[model samples]
Target: MMTANPYSFRKVALGDLDLLMAWQSSPHVQKWWGAQEPYTAADLADPRVARWIVSYDARPFGFMQDYSVHGWENHHFAHLPKGARGIDQFIGDPDMIGVGHGPAFIRTRLQALFDAGAPVIATDPHPDNAQAIAAYKKLGFEPSGPAQETRWGLILPMLLRP
Candidate 1:
């Protein structure tokens, strides 16, 4: 079995636009991420979302985003604490897929959020994205309830509280 790899996150910057586009286009990501339209400059500029490049041992290999769940107008998750946050991520490098890095990376993000005073952390993955859901579960996330239909798509709600 692959061991958990040390990882860090760097804020996504202007120079990373092209890289983000490419990763979103990768079939490995596209199949599960299901992003049909490319992300626009405005999307990247959204202040409500925090995006990061996932680096393993100082080498960039994936992407992650965290945002306040209450930031979305009338979001279903607004019932959570005011400090509740949500995260989504993907390993962009095919070579890194199926490795043991994802759970470690997610744990790091969760710790950062909790340290920053987020009382609740949540994630929603497509029901069919078993790999991603399993990763979240490994980190102590529980299926909060049934599937939710949102503009992005149908997502299986998962939650963690610290």
Candidate 2:
């Protein structure tokens, strides 16, 4: 049996813009993530965020991004420790949902962050996004506070401490 994780992540690049745009436009993705403008060169070069393409068994099927919790002024997670990170992700391939890839890839990414000395990791999923909330819970995230509206949307703050 193959014991190694099947998920792999690669830094998203300019060349991936078309693919990413298509994924972002998918109905399932658009529902949760909203209409996002196309990423610009400056957006991709932003120092505080790391965007990735997630693949399972070498097939790209998702998008994920991690950012410094305190990168933006008055960010809800700013109170977290200095090295804390915030993550947002979605499985873009409709076929990949409910098949275990969300938690699996998220686990792999979170492990990498924790191993690199992140004191905590945070995620803010919409309160009604039960699937997302359940997956986060399975990965050990717990509610840090009540749901609140932010520029991004209404989210339930959750955190995973290393």
All candidates: CA RMSD (Å): 3.1, 1.1
Residue ranges of candidate 1 with Cα displaced over 4 Å:
1-5
Candidate 1 lDDT tens digits, 14-99: 78978888988999999978775756668778988999999998989999999988888887687898889999999988899897
Worst 10 residues of 1 by lDDT: 35-44
Instruction: Report the alpha-carbon TM-score of model 1 versus the true structure.
Output: 0.91
Q: After superposition, how far is residue 26 of candidate 2 from its true place, in Å?
A: 0.8
Could you give candidate 2's per-residue lDDT for residues 46-159 as a string of tens digits? 999999999998999999999998899999999998899999999888999998889989999999999999999999999999999999999999999999999889999999
lDDT of 2 at 2: 67
Per-candidate TM-score against the hidden true structure: 0.91, 0.97
Give the winner by lDDT: 2
